[model samples]
Target: MRPVFRLLSDELIERIISQARDILCDLGMEIHNDGVLSMLSDHGASVDSEKMHVYFTADIIDKALETAPDSVKLFDVMGRQTHDLTDHNVYFTPGSAAINILDPLSGEIRKPLTADYVEYAKLVSRLDNIASQSTAFIPSDVHEKISDSYRLFLSLLYCEKPVVTGAFTIDAFNVMKDLQLAVRGSADALKEKPLTIFSCCPTAPLKWSDVTSQNLVDCAKHFIPVEYISMPLSGFMAPVTLVGSLVQHTAETLSGVVLSQLTQPGTPIIYGGSPAAFDIRFETTPMGAVETQMMDCAYNEIGKYLNLPTQAYIALSDAKKLDAQAGLETSMGATLAALAGINNISGPGMLDFESCQSLEKLVVDNEICGMTLRLARGIEPKEDFPAIPIFEELLREKHLLIANHTRKHLRDEHYFPGRVIDRANSSRWEEEGSLTIGDRAKSEIARLQGEYEPSGLSGDILAEMTRLMRAEAARFGMARLPHEDL
Candidate 1:
């Protein structure tokens, strides 16, 4: 049997779920999408058009739960599967939508540019631990209307990993679909081998915006997976208590699933969240706080209880710099997310309360993810009565390092950190210039950026993707989209 890493009790799981049902059935939700309202009404929900209240009966939520798939398989740009949604695989993608890029050497936070997209995606592709890519930085240089689609375009261009990104509007989402088709060759092929998971966010306090709702429906209609990033801050946007906050999250997520399933049964929907607490002193939503971790673990437990594929917005930091504070907070949150068995963990490279992104931080977080993933791999004994083999080896006066058993099992039993992490003694460190992890990470980043090459997408496909991207930009009133390395 797998180890009991779950946080919520059997009874409490039922209670929280029950509270969510109450919230959905009694309180209903404020939905801003009329088409979604009509869809819900057609599926046995009561829709109040003027009040914008969409109520789900217990029966409807239960049916929607049944319609949601238990797992979602994500594929990379090359049509290779990248994640196992059923094995509790904790895949880390960089944090989504940071406006600024923190330069590792100069320590300057600069407005993101198109080149930042190329460099970031290439670095993430070369890193073994970064299993997927996200729209981590939106280039401030792009036209505002096509910014979201352009990020997806650049991510597809530079990264081979499966994309974890979103669209801001239905029109932008349509453009995103066209871009994927330009690469995949057809809509049917894109649906059958979805290389991206379209994320949609529901507003806090049980509200789903019109665009977010439409995005979910569009993803379902196209058979692409959808992830709901429910963000609720306690004592501000949500209730002060953890249970209260969880209840709101439950309702919000459940509401999304209901709409998605009504749009298309058997649609893949992920139970993902970034819920946190409101800090009074700073008046900020400190996503790396202890309470935020608790919220992450709690909602993850609820997701497990429902047996849905789970994700959480942890593996993050609130530190402005890549300092001790950043390491401490990011490590703790990553470990918690792994323990909770979150499948797709997003937040690497996040800093300054999710307002900034850094490439060095991405390398540092990779080591942390390796350690957390090692811990999540619960202990498995190799042999029965293994102490006898150990005793015999000791009796022979043979060092364990030279033993066959040691040679065979060391890789499984221990996690050897990457080159970025230092594990040597003081003397050895002095010989190696006493490089800090940051210094080593800088070296690694440079090596990756130098060695990286964009996968040679077919010339025909490349031209088509470019055409779709430029046409959308022109539609958005741009005479021309800014040219990059492409």
Candidate 2:
């Protein structure tokens, strides 16, 4: 119900402001992108091209927060239900940008296909634990025709849940628009409530890319929520000190929020980051490393101080295989984020420094998400004391709480595990075929797939979507589209 950890107190927030001012004045972010620099100059923020630094003060950040909505309604594409981001419970979403899916049995990495992505999406949508879904897995290779927008399209087609997505290129915006049309069946549907788009802008200490900046502006105009993901690699792109990283992340995220607000006042935004560190010896960005977890915890504090909806990259690992280290890191990072009460936690099923995804892991992570959600609900105190006289009488004879009244309460209080999780003893498990967790998970996936009924799309609406997608493809000068079946 309440956040278990606070990263920034009143004194700490002031300290972050002081440090941000120092970074801008002394060591500034490198703005290699010219367009970003020009925008900064156009705004009141100071930009020195020579120094390649953009200095944004706390006042600018305040104005940005003021323009941002405290909460946003994330719409379900299937017109099922909307999730209120203002709720106290932390929501879990699937991972993002995974190029490979690690084979748990073989330990070999394989490129994921569109079918694989669709299956995964359906699986996630069916799970009660996942509050939202992301086109988390991208096909490693697709026909050139649909290569550009394949992931977004697949996500729109397969998922019925609220989607957490980002724009990879300028054209991706159009892809999103087409998908919106498909979901709503008409342009007027968008006017009521458009799909929430979370566009990531590079860190404050780093210039926003041209494509990313343009996408942010477009999303604001469409009234889509833009989630500014400030990924500052401390000890590499940023200072190694925690305070230093926090300051840089704050300034960068605030700047993004400001730009979105300036483009469209009252636009919703999430203060988010994927800040991590480069493993010096390994020469890699460790997604589930302890340092990454620490950064996530600290930055979450910073976001709370600003009083904005927060999103963080957690529930990932650096391990190439689903080994002990992978399990440990992913569990630790995910549990910490959940306990801290982050609004949105990403990076489930992610591995190999966030470059790979595993379907098996995704299912396993959903169980973790389910456990965390239960934990976040905290322990409920009994209102009526549960028939004190009867309970005391039962306790007097025996310590067993399995009496009729107690049994009823126990059933109500317990959180049941799904098919994949084994609570049975060895004897019972052996009788049931002695399946390992992975085997059981695969079976569960198959069962769900068999039972899943595709969301109803009228023939007319389907035709319209096909027409628009083809028209867009033609506009892009492509004769064929990738994943045409979608």
Q: What is the TM-score of each candidate against the true structure?
A: 0.96, 0.89
Residue-level lDDT tens digits of model 2 in 1-486: 443865557798878866665655345455555666666667667788877567765555566677788776677776665666653447888787677787645658988777778777778767777778776766755644454466766666666677787767777687677667677866656645656556576744556666777777777777777778887777888788767777788767766776688677787778778888867787777878777777787777766766777888898788776556767787888888888777888877888877888877777777878777767667765433666867677669676466665576674556677887789998999999998777876777787777776656565665666666667667757565556665
Worst 10 residues of 2 by lDDT: 140-149
Colliding residue pairs in candidate 2? none
Residue-by-residue lDDT tens digits, candidate 1, 1-486:
234366679798799889989989988999998999988888888989999998899888999999888888887877888887754667888888898889877989988888777889899988777799998988888788888999999888877888888997788989898888877778788877877888889999889899999999999998888888898899999999988899889889988889888899988788988898899899999888999989988898888788888888898899888889999999999988888788889899999877899999998898899888888887877763658978788679756777777888888789887788888899999999999888998998998889897776787877888788988988868766665544
CA lDDT, candidate 2, residue 425: 93
Report the number of the highest-lDDT candidate. Answer: 1
Give the clash count for model 1.
0
Each prediction's Cα lDDT score? 0.86, 0.72
Clashes of each: 0, 0
TM-score of 2: 0.89
Best by TM-score: 1
Report how far off residue 196 is in candidate 2 (Å): 3.4
Off by over 4 Å in 1: 1-4, 383-385, 394-397, 479-486
Candidate 2: C-alpha lDDT: 0.72
Model 2: CA > 4 A from native: 1-3, 21-43, 47-59, 103-107, 143-148, 185-194, 384-387, 393-412, 474-486
lDDT of 1 at 101: 85
